[model samples]
Target: MNPWALSGVVLVAAVTFYLGKRSSRYANTTHDFLVARRTVRSRRNAAAISGEYLSAASFLGVAGVVLKEGADALWYPIGFTAGYLALMLFVAAPLRRSGAYTLPDFMEARLASEPLRKLCTVAVVAIGVLYMLPQLQGAGLALEAVMPAPAWLGAVGVTVLVTVNVMAGGMRAITVVQAFQYWLKLFALAAPTFVLCVVFFGTGGAGSAGSLGDPAPPVFREDTTVTVETGASFEVSEETPVWLPAEEGGQRVWLPGVRYEVDEGTTLRFPEGAPVPAVSGGEMDNASWLRPAEDAGALLGTYSLIFATFLGTMGLPHVLVRFYTNPDGKAARRTTVQVLVLLGLFYMFPVLIGALSRMYVPELLVTGRTDAAVLLVPSAMLPGVPGQILGAVTAAGAFAAFLSTSSGLLVSVAGVVATDVLAGKVRDFRIATVTMAALPAALAVSLPVEDLSLSVGLSFALAASTFCPLLVLGIWWRRLTWPGAMVGMCVGGGLVLLALVLNVLSEYSGGWAPWFIEQPALLTVTAAFLATIVVSLGTARRIPDDVNAVMLRLHAPDPLGFMRDRAEARFGRIEDRSRKRGKHRK
Candidate 1:
């Protein structure tokens, strides 16, 4: 009743997943534990990627931005989906071809140096930790909003649950779980959206809607108003207050201050004490960009979001690691495409829900929890038992979102920790998994003080700074030596660390700050890419010939040895047919 949908969703999610624990036993071998035994089909793997990729930021945060900013919110989803396309075109096949379990493994082989490997390992762990914090914080926020639980309880519960699942099952277990969670998230969002749309328009189609007459025009329900003292001498009553109450549910709901609509470039200000007015179609442009500071930016915001999404996907260790789960490079490529389509389809609903919320759940604006827009939209739009059922579905979706992404992040971290930290040193893989998973829980406790999305964005920027350069160069450039990789990682990683430090100090010290958030990714990534390239070019003479052969093996399916045999088995038949054809022609 009090917007406890998030808590109910999280509880149901934990229980559903807990009951499904036996499924984790499927991951038995190191390969299975690391990459789901490299047998994940294209469609399912794609869905899983899309599932994990669509975090709370996309589902809830972006939509809230749209409610406040208008068209700009559309960019978050567009950029996210398009990023998968980039993965499909550039990174997917090559990454799979690398035949490495973790990014560190790939770095070790490519750079042929332990130091580079260590750098990669540290970066992987750092990025994973950074990424995990938001999911935990969002989980806490979701739980607190949905249930009567303390925010920290949500974080603790999710961290523990995710740690257990990831450590117990590893990649093998998480693959299945993420896949199931993806469909669950889609269903949860889709089911509620469909019902809400019906409730919004009643039995009639869009043209016969009750609220705004034919093809209901979007309306704003103001929660708080800002009163500006212009110091103009005028009659108080005749001078109309900038904001006014609109009759809704038999009460005059008013916003306190001057409200202006930004239709294209025109500003339509509602004079003080005027009744809140509804604008149709073209007229709604006045209020467009003036609603909130977060929403007042331009399309550049979308492009920035997209840049982060597309590049960020390549840098995400969990998403990249999934490429290893494919049977071969081709399957990996196929999986990326599948993920793109699924991600695109799933995104459409959130944008709609957020847009719809602009009209119905405007109360969230007053409540200081616009992030809860996704969960609250269904309840606010659809009344009675139907609304309750829809609310449960939305809760389930949000829970699935947290669970899937959190599971993937934890699995990626555990993999890096096991292979790099505890490899050969730890007697048991299970023990290693537990240790790796628990460390992030400690980090999650410190996240609430920061912005969750920005934390994730910084993780992306850092990721782009370090890995994006490392990956593109590793795959495309042949001259990259160990020294190049090591130096490049340091340059990129250092920049990211520096940006983060500056941001923290600025917040703590209250001083003028640098362009830490705005351009960190662009600068760090460029420097790292350039450093790697220049260093590799300088050391080209010492480049080994073995690299070509290894790369060939990485890219092409050899009949005798593909990932210890799987790739070649499929290609072996093709080679045999060619030989037979030659024999027949002779």
Candidate 2:
């Protein structure tokens, strides 16, 4: 057990507790809990949004994917940051101008349909839960790397801490905590990265790794010994010499390059600059790893991934809720601009870490545990105390990613449950938080873990299919009717939901799941747009009576006082400006 890593994680938890406790007093109303009373300024709101946006996927999964898939994995971070562009261009200011606390609130207010609102409420919770699974998976990986504990303990720890924080002060407390976490995360990743780059490059270690364009697979930077903890099978492209463990007679042998299956507890030692073995006998090849595959299915999946991320940002419930905390439409827009800059800055560091890990931690590739690339890189590159300290910093950053994103998502889910299912009061919100968090927490512990980035992609594809079309058309198109919007959402959302269910079944049943089922974003998003347009045109006469008024409000400046209807009929006490305030003689 590394004391440095454990202490770093504990320190981060202590800080989170302190911040959440300090902000607990001000969350006195639903508005404060749901939207921070719409009083957060642009700069701080941007930091919180970026903080929550950079989840487990960004911190750990991206690096892992890069280590496994090479250049193709670069698309994940690119898509993640680019998604914000869609929000800024189409959704941000208009959604904030609508003055709604949640997605369901907007649906009911925009179309004047309670049924549509309820439909969206279900969708929000589904997306929130799906998104949370990956965060917990990442949390587990981080803790398990540094300490001798079961992976489920890390999952439960994150779930419990986030639930307590969200239940304590809701969005008001989360805002401050998330913003602070963003800076800490930035420092944690940045400081170690600076040192790693300087030491590795300045000390002439760079020349041994070779270029990305090198035809041969990556080589071990130095003589290294590795043992398979579970089991792994990998292929070699060239004859390689490996020294077996002492129990296996401790002899070195030249094995022909072929698919070799290894049992658990197998250990091997490779000499310095030896070519790394290829896993799955495909992308691990140096040139193949650097370029896109030529297969049609692979091409289609890539497009789906790009669309899922590019269009999915505006649709994410947790991300969308941050905009509502902005005081006005302009602030929301400004905050998005700032978020774009912050996110772009943070993504490059993880990419560098992944690239470096390829040379230093080549054994992870053979073992199919590339997700540990980021956590292991610092130690693999630098040995002993210095490496442990840097690894601890990274583990802390990973925790930040888990807690911030999980808290934001839990709050969003709880708010939906409180407003849609319960009495929509502060008390209901508190109860809903605990209730909403419980199911995901249990599932995170019991369910088998998945690749964090891929799991997050499932949520993005679902969001893109369902909410992206609704927000874009709802704000811009005056001819949109409630029936049309409902049908479109059902068609698009239903496909993705079905895909998710089938994907889950395939895991247990050993059935073949197609690429489209795993990544339906491109197809579903197009179907949603087409369905919404066709259905609306057919039902043009059924448009809302106040369509023009709503459109004007969505587009007009906030100071004009025509920005929105708050839909208080369902979610009462969201804001009560006429209520008396406590006064004192000054």
Candidate 3:
């Protein structure tokens, strides 16, 4: 076991628990627990939002994609950062002005329909669950960098940590934890990046990284050993010799050329400058990898990916819930601005690691575990104690990414379950935290780990297909009817889920559908928007009577003293201008 790596994990956990317990003291009421009484400041809330937004996919998967796909993978981070731009421009101020605690609350408030609110609550939970799975899987990958352990350990550990922290203080507590984690993740990534740059670019180091324009596949920069965790098929570009470790403590043997297949637990050592075999399912030379689109199918997937991430931000329940923690519409917008800057800064390090990994850690390509590139690179580049220390730091940051995002997701999930599924009580929220995390933890431990970014992108596609339209239309369009919202979300969410099922079936049956059908966002998002519009236009007479008043509340400046929730009786209000003037101090 690497003590430094283990220590970093312990340190982060200690800090998280300490902050959570400290914050829990003030979160006595439901409002405080759910939205931090809307007292979080712009900068602090932005940090927390950034923390939660940069999940395992950003920490490891972005670099993994870059290492594998090269220039084309640049779109992942671009799409991710661009998403918040959409959120800020279209949804941020307006959503905050709506005075809703959850996405369901927003729906019900906007449409004045209880049935539609219930549907939204269900969608929030579904998206939260979908997003949570990657965080848990990322936890497993992070732990492996520290020490070899069962996949279940990381999932269970993160679940318990998230549950304890969330159950203690909810959003109020997690805001602080997530904010701290954002910086921690930044430092974790930035430090290694600096050292690697010096080692790779500076004199007396590894020398210049290989040119990106090379047409050949990435080769081992130095002799490397790669262990295949499961039986898998991948193709080697050329005949190459390799050293294979024998089973049952037998002697090692030099295998000549064309090692095309590997079984579980197979360990193969390659000589320096040997071609790194590409994964069997998809293989590309450096020239193709560097380019944006390969063919019709890949080009379609790229468009779908960008579309899903950009529009999908509004649909993410965890992200939108954070805006409620801001005091007003302006604060939410300011928070978004800060979030954009912080996200832009954090994303740079991932691209650096990914680009460098192409030269430094190509064994991952052969192993089909490209996600481990960031975790493995520090030690691979810098030998001895320095590498170990950096490795530990990277591992800690990875864990923090998992915990930070998972905490936010758990809070959002618990909010829906407690408010919509249960009695909407403090006790119910506490119960819901555990209940929401339990299923995902179990699934994370049992299920096979997929591509982290791909899994997360699918969650984005699902959200984009469903709630993106619900949100964009609900906020902008006055004619949106309850039936329209319901039909649109259901149709959109249903199609994505159907595509997922089809994807599974096709994967097992070896009969995958075309790119649009498998990816689905490009088509599904359009379908949802059309469905909502068509249904609402057909049911034009069903618009809420107070649509004008609600629109005034949403669009009006903050000083007007328009009601927070004029139609809802849950919150009290100030009334009578003469009486208020008489009671008012200068």
Candidate 4:
């Protein structure tokens, strides 16, 4: 363990906890706990939103994917930022104007149905959990790279810190902490990237000579030692001498065109300028990696990814909740605009980091853990004290990624659990926070590591299939009914869930199934939009009686108007009823 790096990470966590505890003073009411009484400024809320939105996928996984997949992977960040534009034009203002605390609250307020609200709550929890697992897993991967502790420690530590902060202050506290985190993350990544760029140019801007897609394999810049954590078969591109564990015999000469069984804990040494072997799964060369959609299947997958990410941002539980924190409809719109700017700036660095890693840390490609590219590259290129410090900064940024995103997810999930499942009280919120944080942390630790960005994209696809349709039609189309919304959510969410399960199963079965599973968004997202539209038109007669009033409130700009007052009155009535029910249960 590099004590300096570990100490930096520890200090970040400590300061985060203190910030949250300090903000707890403002979270005295249920309203403040959930949406900070809708008092947040546009700029601060924008930072907080960006902080939470740039999850492990953006912090680590994007660079890793770009490192492995090249230009095609650029779509990840493009789609991510573009999704916010869609949100700005369509969902942001209306969602905030609806004056709802959660997605479920929005559904119930819009359609006047408790059942659909409950159904939406289920979708929220599912998406939240699916989204959170990758964050925990990413944290673990990052910590394991820099420290001697078990991989699970990073996930557990983040979960605990996030839970404590969220339980103490909720959205109000999280807003302050997450806003600070956005700047912290930007500094951490940007500073190193600037220095690395200088170093690269100072060293004559020499890049990797290896082609990513051809017969030519990646060449190491220096003699390196690679320890295999799991046993796997690798294709040797050249005759290389590899060192194995003494217990498993000794060093042996490896030949080209032969598959080698690299046992767990086996250490291999490759001389400088030697060709790096490719791993078994989805290893692409520079030509294929740089090319966008080299085949019909690749084209479909690319389009599906674009479709999911472009539409998915509007429906994310954590992302949507941030809009509710804004002061009004216009503020929400402004916050989203700021978010696009901030995100656009932040995403530029990751791609550069990814490209740099291909030259500096090709060993990661052999291990099939390209996600560590951002964390590994600084030390590989710089070395010594400077490298250690830079590596620690990157690690701290990675932790901030986990902490910010997990905190947002926990708040959204815990809010739902407290409001819909338990009594909507502070104590209930605290309990739900623990449950939400712990369950995902446990799963992240136990499950085998998978592609972090891919898992996060799947969650986005699920959201696009489920809530995207609900929010789009609910806000813009007045004909939507409770039954239509419910059925659409069931069919859309259910089909995507089924597709996800089949995709997981197909990993074993292999063939065309994997292609469809890998990119179900094209089908699932389309099916969801169609299902909602068709069911809504068919149930036009069942539209709520107060549809005009709700629509007016959602669209109108004046926050102090009659429609706004009416909506607030309704919320007050609902709260009174909820409090009475709680008293009765007590």
Candidate 5:
């Protein structure tokens, strides 16, 4: 364990806690706690939004995916950023104009149906919890890399910190803390990248010489030791010597064309320039890794991934909640634009880091823990005090990623639970915070750590399947009725949920099922949209009586004189009535 890295991460957590405490002063009211009284400026709100949106997937998983899958993985970052563009164009302004604090609030107000509201609240909590698992797992993985701690420790520790921050100041505090974290994350990634680039170029840039997809397999650049944490079977491309567990015998010479099983906790020492063995997942040469899909099935998977990510952003509960913080519709649009720029800038570093890891850290491939590339690569490349400092910087950034995203998710899920399940009050919010945080933290520890990016992508697929249709139809299609929205959410969410269950089971069944399970969004998203439209059109006569008024409120800019006058008149009448009652009583 490196003390400097540990201290740096601790310091970041402390500072985040302090910031949350300081922001608590502004969160006295329920409105403030839920939406910061809708007063956040665009730039700061954008930062907070970006910070929360860039979860474990962006901070760590992207690089790992890129390292293992090569150019194909680049789609993760591109789709992530493009999703915001889709949001800006379609959902941002109108969602903010809806004057709703959460998705359930929007559903209730828009559809004027309590049942629909309850359904949406359930979906929000489900998506939030699913989305949070990867963040927790990423935290555990990062901490384990830097310190001698069980994987669950990091998950539990982060959950506690996030809970405190959320309970302390709610949305107001989370906004301030998350905004700061965006820059911290940016600096943490950018600085190490700059240094690593210098180191790479200074050493003749040989790392960049070959295509990552070259048919030739990767080889160790130096003598190396790799300990398998999980038992895996791998193929030997050439004859090689490997150390074995005591029970298996001291050392054995592995031969070409044979598969060998490496048990958990088994350590293998490889000589310099030896070819890295390919695991059971199948090996990719630089050529295959860098190339786009060469087959129809691969092409389908790529498109499905793109479709899910591009459409999924607007549906993320945590991200959509951030729009509520903006002062107005225009501010919401501005916030999204700013988010695009910030996200684009921050995503560049992770891909580079992943590429570098392929050359410097091939052992990660053998271990099947490529997600650790960002956290492990710096120290591997630079080794010594400088490397430790860089690693510390990366570690701090990673923890910040977990903290910011987890806090935002907690706030979103807790708000839904408080309003829908518990009483909608500050005390209830606190209680809901604890419940929401605990459930996911427990799951994070209990569930096997699957591919971080893939897990998150499943969350995205769910969101895209369920909420994407509701929001799109809700905003643009006036024929949508309460029953239509409810059915759409249920059917769409239900199908995706079914797909998710089948996906888990398919892992055991094996065969062609895994491919469809891995990317359900292509079919599920279309089903959702079709169901929503058909049901909505069929139930056109059941549209709410005040549909015109609601549409005006959602589509019109907030500065319109009549809308302002109407709001003032309503509040003014309430105040006058209160004063008259007071005088009569006296």
Candidate 6:
């Protein structure tokens, strides 16, 4: 419960709030709120995109994984950064050219059906809500860990802060906030890591540092009353009893026959008390077929995670909504590539910190707070003022990560709920936005804190299931009909929701009732895609001729007026344009 630490976090948040308020005044209309009037340049927008994409999970969780799991954990960040690669190649230009404020808008224009729009809207809101929960939960967990505050309080506070930022200022405000937060987050981590390394090396523990201690030794307990007669020295805990021989350490530090109660299931470790016994050994030639399977199995797991991330990036609603905010298709494409570069740069630092945590702060594994492993590493490496300053900076970075990401998810969910369900009815949009943001905050309060990465993965599963197919097929395929889109959305959306529910139930009930499916992305995404294609084929004759025209606009490069012109060409005659022009003059 450090007041200074908590105050630092709150001060940083206050500054972010001020920046958001100042930036939001630019949003005056629905277009401004939804897409920043489609005027954001590619470079700044690219940084903003990277800022939103790298959530608290990526910042904090990845390092923890690397610390615990060795090189295998590096795959998470690789998959995350590589996701933008897939987007740049396939989804960027067409999605921006679709001339829609949101995915549901794209659906209405693409299929020319109010029914399909409604279905897509349903899926959008559902997935948005699911995705928001983890952001809220991450915020709570971060605040709880760094400060003495209760987790629920942090969750509620962040919900209010982000909701205000979005509702008051809209996309313009969020853009500025995210862009600024990205740099803040980067330096926050980078500064501490460098300082920690310098301090560690300067402490004269360079090469032959083994003399400092034998890596904390494993503790083993034989029975309850095992007494230690340390001829030299020893340390015993409730969990284990060990005796040190006269030659172990250099002095006798333990008394004999001191009976004590041993607490089972607890952990204890010995320091540099036991002397090493040198031995020469030959290569052990024991090999088994199981070894190959174990290695292959690990590789399969890594590939599965990477695959889910790459394809799943294309389907994320928040990410897709950002594309809709671009002024033109080319700008969107440029933004995508820039985002790749920005993310690639950001990924390098986290991997370095993760590796450092593995070597230096191995104790974090005992407490299962590997998520905070990076944040605490600097303090462990540098013990005084420099360490404290580095810790504060890292905390600020983590706070920035949570705030920027939560704001993005809040805007995405609230925008969808407002536009689709309420249709910009002021009162209803306000209510929907408030409720959408508030529900997750409340739910986050109830969660018994879990690893941030696991929760983020669930959010990805929801996004992949509901919106991935809708965006992919709607953009690339013209034959996709309204009924087909609706059916596909329902099947895909339904499977994802069902999978999530089954997962929760299985977690609570603990059995093989649902067949124990872990990764839902592959199956759910395929089902959605298949459903769209099948239904569209069955209803192919009902396809509208305007589909070809709209598809061209989405796929081809044109000026910013491309959408307005295509809209006019599809629905307006010469007389209609003249009438519109006349009205504009008046």
Estimate every model's Cα lDDT from 0 to 1: 0.65, 0.84, 0.83, 0.84, 0.84, 0.66
Per-residue lDDT, model 2, residue 36, is 76
What clash count does candidate 6 reach? 4
Return the clash pairs for model 3, or none.
Answer: none
* TM-score per candidate, chains pooled: 0.79, 0.91, 0.92, 0.91, 0.92, 0.80
Tell me the number of clashing residue pairs for each predicted model.
21, 0, 0, 5, 5, 4
For model 4, how does the per-residue alpha-carbon lDDT over 1-586 read when each residue is reduced to its tens digit? 7666787788889889998998876466676668766778999999999999999999999999887778889999999999999999999998988878899989998999988888999899999999999999998998888888888999999999999999988987899899989999998899999999899878865655353435465687777788876556676656766666778667777777676777666788877777777665444355555667677887788999998899999989999999887767888999999999999999999999998887678888767688998888888878798988998898899999999999999999999999889888888888999998889999999998877899999999989889998899999998888888887778777877888788777655533375557788888878877877888788888899999989988998754664342234423543454354331100
Query: Candidate 5 or 6, higher lDDT?
Result: 5
lDDT of 2 by residue, 370-486 (tens): 778888888877889999999999999889999999999999999989988998888999999999888888888887666789999989988998899999999988888888888
Task: Judging by lDDT, tell me the better candidate of 1 and 6.
Answer: 6
| Tens digit per residue, CA lDDT, model 1, 372-410 | 778777666665666766777777777777778888887
Which 10 residues in a row give candidate 6 its minimum summed lDDT?
A: 277-286
C-alpha RMSD values across all candidates: 9.2, 3.5, 4.3, 4.6, 4.7, 9.1
Show the lowest summed lDDT stretch of 10 residues, model 2.
577-586
Q: Give me the displacement of residue 533 in model 6, in angstroms.
A: 2.0
Q: Quote model 6's TM-score.
A: 0.80
- Report the CA-based lDDT of candidate 2 relative to the real structure: 0.84
3 or 6, greater by lDDT: 3
TM-score of 2: 0.91
lDDT of 5 by residue, 1-586 (tens): 9888899889999999999998876466566567776778998999999889888999999998888787778889999999999899989988888877789988887888988888898899999999999999999998998999999999999999999999987998888899999999999999999999999878865643233545776777777788887766777666766666667887778777776877777888877777777665454456556676667776787888997899988899999999987767999999999999999999999999999888788789878788898988888778799999999999999999999999999999998898788767889999999999999999999987877999899898889888998888898888888888878778877877887788767655533364556787888888888888888888888899988988898898778821221122212332343344331100
